[model samples]
Target chain A: MGAGVTVDRLAELLVSHFGAPADRVAGGVTFEELEFDSLALVELAMVAQKEFGVEVDEQEFTPEQSVAGAARLIDSRRAAS
Target chain B: MPQAMPGFGVAVTGLGLVTPAGIGVDEVWRRVLSGEPTAAPDPALEGMPVDFSCRVPGFDPDRELGRRAAWRLDRSSQLAVVALREALRDSGLDPSTWDGARVGVVIGTALGGVQTYEAQQRELDSSGVGAVSPLLVPMSAPNMVAGYLAMECGASGPNLVTATACASGATAIGTARELLRGGRCDVVITGGVDAPITRTMIAGFTRMGALSRRTSDPRAASRPFDTARDGFVAGEGAAVLVLERNHDARVRGARVHGLISGYGASADAHHATTPDPSGAAAERAVRSALEDAGLSAHDVDHVNAHGTSTKLNDVTEARLVRGVFGDGVAVTSTKGVTGHALGAAGAIEAVCTLLALRDDVVPPTANLDSLDPEVEVDVVAKEPRPGRLRAAVSNSFGFGGQNAVLVVTRS
Candidate 1:
């Protein structure tokens, strides 16, 4: 949230924290495309809150959303707050 | 109908052990042969009443299992999956080519993913319900040990977890025999696993006075059948055996490690935690197992007593063995070397029995300085005894008065 919450920063978090394959964690790939299940998404939500200090609803963090899209949402939420 | 091969018991084609003694069948057997106790002080139990335990040495989940898989599974399931892979490979059965529906999985566990449950409960208490893991139920459920193994091996047949306390493993093996005999499946992957060394679990057992508190000398804590023995040392591990009908194993040209000739189970109907002092119901299971194998007392060569190192269990088990097999049969408790693996104890002992049959050598019960005068059975101690061991019985009695006995024969 402080620095812009870049797509690259989000990708690093997924790969390092979530055991997501490095090759598969790209900006254009949707979470569903990356095979992140519902349970994983919920866990990701909790991790994101702690890491970025921004509240993200697990339900709203849709599987169809791409990693880049997620970064933009976090950045927008930070600006609005 | 499943073809019945009368007088021919199910073949134990393969065995996989991840135990406190060491990992894999050969490593654990080697350590057991040396009579080296694996118990030591645990940093996690630093402040507890009993600060030591027997842990599976050098078990790295992230390295043994991939980070992706290990992160999702509980410690118990991780152990089961690793052991299962070994078992399947040893059985010479390729899951990719085998009929998935014809393979079954049965796991026995006294406590399943208890560490995970405790951690999640702590998270809930401190960080509210929202912070709790969504994977908690699937990861910590008592049935997930078998469920995860089934998923790992693509086994679609009968899959369930048996939870009869300490007798769970023996009960699982017996139930797997029934599945094979009833033609439920041609191959059954069955065993027991438990990682119950959490602070809460150790504390609970400590409260029950079920653990050995010889903190000064951790290695000498689990002294089965010895007069100076106090109680069992809590441990964690897993053992899996691939079971197939004798004819099926022969047809496939699988290497038969041994045969689970007979299995018997009974309830004491006596007490919750205390084994029947009379050893009545426990004897019934032993006699029934021998009878089921069409074997008499004189036919058995050795006895792998449950021998938990606890006074009640060791004394009662010794009396039962002496009552059933007289004075000449060789007896030993591997628990003295590996510590008490609780739910995994039965299966681990069964594998040891098979190895004993294979090599015709009975490993000594570690830390048995002086045998109890009341225990009249011939307990092999001090060193491993080399002899002709044809058939051996492994006994497992659990809390809630549950007793399970298995009769294993050299193939």
Candidate 2:
């Protein structure tokens, strides 16, 4: 994950991955609220890792978390690196 | 041999056909009875080893099925859905009044959505992964047709897809009949669909020497029982039948199209692609279907032969017919007119069988100029043969030595 990656960028990434309507892509919206299944989460993680070089462990993430929550975790991992 | 597992006596009330000959029951039957080969040069398949194929002419899925539904389904699934809609309408059943949960759907298909798979792969190559439609899995899965059919008819009782190569459709219908006899549902939508005219499949089948290469003469390519018969012409389409309890149909005063008195299936267990030339298992299938129907071989007046026009299938099926029904029974291969529709062959032939029983006419084997000396059976040719048909059997033998036979008696 890059330090420059922000909450809005993370939410936009998920919205694009899911083909969700742009208006529905709120940063605090949970994956479950966004109507994404486990497969969708796995795919989003795959694309995120491929693009930003950050690993998203499936066990560490939950559908309850919002896109901002995931973005913060990515920022923390990058800061540590 | 699986014994005749007849359940409560199932009756076919409606039939839907989307074939190379044409769409709808009457149109396809008329074309088939005309003894005109439906195979034509597929411009989309030009330059391929076997460019000509038997395509469902004038098929507009967007028009037949609405835009949303057509977008959500593969071509195979589209064909199934369209045929299913037609069959349900033909059956005169009020779906809104019926119990959707009690209905069942079983479809037979070999390559479910290979066409979709091919197109998506091309898209993935040209564009990025993001360009792929989210419904690809649902659209392309082999069982998706059954799933979509369930969605269409609200069939929740027992829905499944059988993939027994060429024998798939017949197997699905037989399996559905058994489920009905077992009291699984009040009605079942059963049939098969296939669209295998893609370049890769054509090339693969061509390499296996399974497709006819008589591109110059598309009309004469599928010459079943003829000495010049080389291979089967690849065809695409779907056929569906609405089957219900015979007693219930009678009580409702429904117009019974035909009675599925018997269903028999067996395996050669010999080879994967090549059938056993001895025709033992295939012979058993016919005998078992007859036994299951509670009818003797002499009762069957017409035989819808699976004469694929291939070197082995025609001769082997001819011998099987002779061995089972003796030499007097009328036999004709509808494949000679519609080409080989793969998984849907049996279901389409089943429709043809019912039509033959109703009209008392055996559709001719198209393009049979000279019957092979090796074939001793009476293969109908030239024009439709009008006869007194009390009972008929449709035989389907697939790549894995699978054999299935369905016996239908006059309604």
- The candidate scoring highest on TM-score is 1
lDDT of each: 0.91, 0.86
Task: Show model 1 residue runs off by greater than 4 Å.
Answer: A1-6, B1-6
DockQ of 1: 0.63
- Model 1 chain A worst lDDT window (10 residues): A1-10
Q: Give candidate 2 regions above 4 Å deviation.
A: A1-81, B1-8
Query: How high is the lDDT of residue A14 in model 2?
Result: 62
DockQ of each: 0.63, 0.05
Report interface Cα RMSD per prediction: 1.2, 7.5
Put down candidate 2 lDDT per residue, B1-411, tens digits, no spaces: 123344235889988999999988889999999999999999879899788999999998867875435656789988888899889989999887899877999889988998988887887898667545556687788989999888887777888999889989999998988877877888999999999889988999999999888988888999999999999999999999999888889999989998888988999999988999999999999888988888899888999998999999999888888888889799999999999999999899989999999999999999999999999999999989998999999999999999999998988
For candidate 2, the per-residue lDDT at B231 reads: 98
Model 2, range A40-65, lDDT digits (tens) per residue? 67656656665566666655456898
Among residues 3 or more apart in sequence or in different chains, the pairs in candidate 2 whose N, CA or C atoms overlap within 3 Å are B7-B181
